[model samples]
Target: MTKSKTFWAASALISLALMVFAGYSIYGRVALHFSGDTIEVKPVPLPAAEEQEEEKVDTKSALEKIKAAEKEDKEEEAKAGRGTPAKTEVPRMRAVKTAFEYKDSAAKSVLISGSFTSWKDKKMTKKDGVWKTDIYILPGTYPYHYTVDGKKKLAPGKPKAPTGDSLVTVN
Candidate 1:
């Protein structure tokens, strides 16, 4: 074969090998991601017939007590010269402590961004091969994702948001 032809063939083979290596690397990372996680299921016991009947009775009594309490409140308001209580402002929701975690041993840096953070990246701390961050958030549903080494990745096993991010409900 001509030297030029040999050089071209060698280049093509090298390119093919590089592509395969890249593909395998990606596959291994993905496999590690899925395989390292675990899920636990605990069986729940059904209530006894007597317990179910008692629960129904208790629920009815509780509802009746609530109605009586509301009636007393309205009567007190009327006596206080407020015929109907003025519309009270809704109480602000308290922020709840929420934890976010991700596992990626190869990542140099991990960050989290979401509606809670106004889409700003928040750096996560790494410990024992896991990345973790705790943020206080108001009770509601929010969409979020991780940025590992500057690349976006969804939370594993989480429901996808409309914008293709992971969904987290804080309460």
Candidate 2:
């Protein structure tokens, strides 16, 4: 009979393992007649009908609770507003990024990694020193840096981040 190589190999392996285990167990029993082993087994009783009835009855209430939770989340977000965010929250942004093209690779492409911006490579490199990249950013002040490869490099002292990797705050 013809069998696929993979199928035969898998079947043979499983049969071999079973046979070996069976042989080992038999050998252990025959050679070392006495055997003693213990395993703990416990049965946990499920909650009875009254509790189950109450639990099932509460599903609607649970759904209401979930709705209430979602409503609370929305309220909290609105109250927090775009500008007023937790120290950890970098609010979602639309503008996202700003790119520059320098003269050459004298500068490096840096990822604006921080709570304020979300993009990895926030800046771009110029063919020679030109940069062309946009920074997705929230509408607020953000502390960021110009990363050359992986290290931080101070942007030239210019008002705009694209011009001189100066620390910029988006509004």
Clashing pairs in 1: none
Q: Which ten residues in a row have the lowest lDDT in candidate 2?
A: 33-42
lDDT of 1 at 135: 97
Q: In candidate 1, where is summed lDDT lowest over 10 consecutive residues?
A: 35-44
Model 1, 1-171: lDDT tens digits are 699999999999999999999999888755643553321222345767998899999999998998798788888989988866656476888999999999998899999988778778999999999999999987777778999999999999987765568888875
Model 1 regions lying over 4 Å from their true place:
1-64, 73-92
Model 1: lDDT to the true structure: 0.83
lDDT of 2 at 157: 55
Could you tell me every candidate's TM-score relative to the true structure?
0.54, 0.32
Candidate 2 C-alpha lDDT tens digits along 1-171: 356888899999999999999999788654432232211122345767997889878997998998798778778888878554344355554774645333335544544443344323455636545655665554554334556777765546534342233455554
Candidate lDDT values, in order = 0.83, 0.55
Best candidate, lDDT: 1
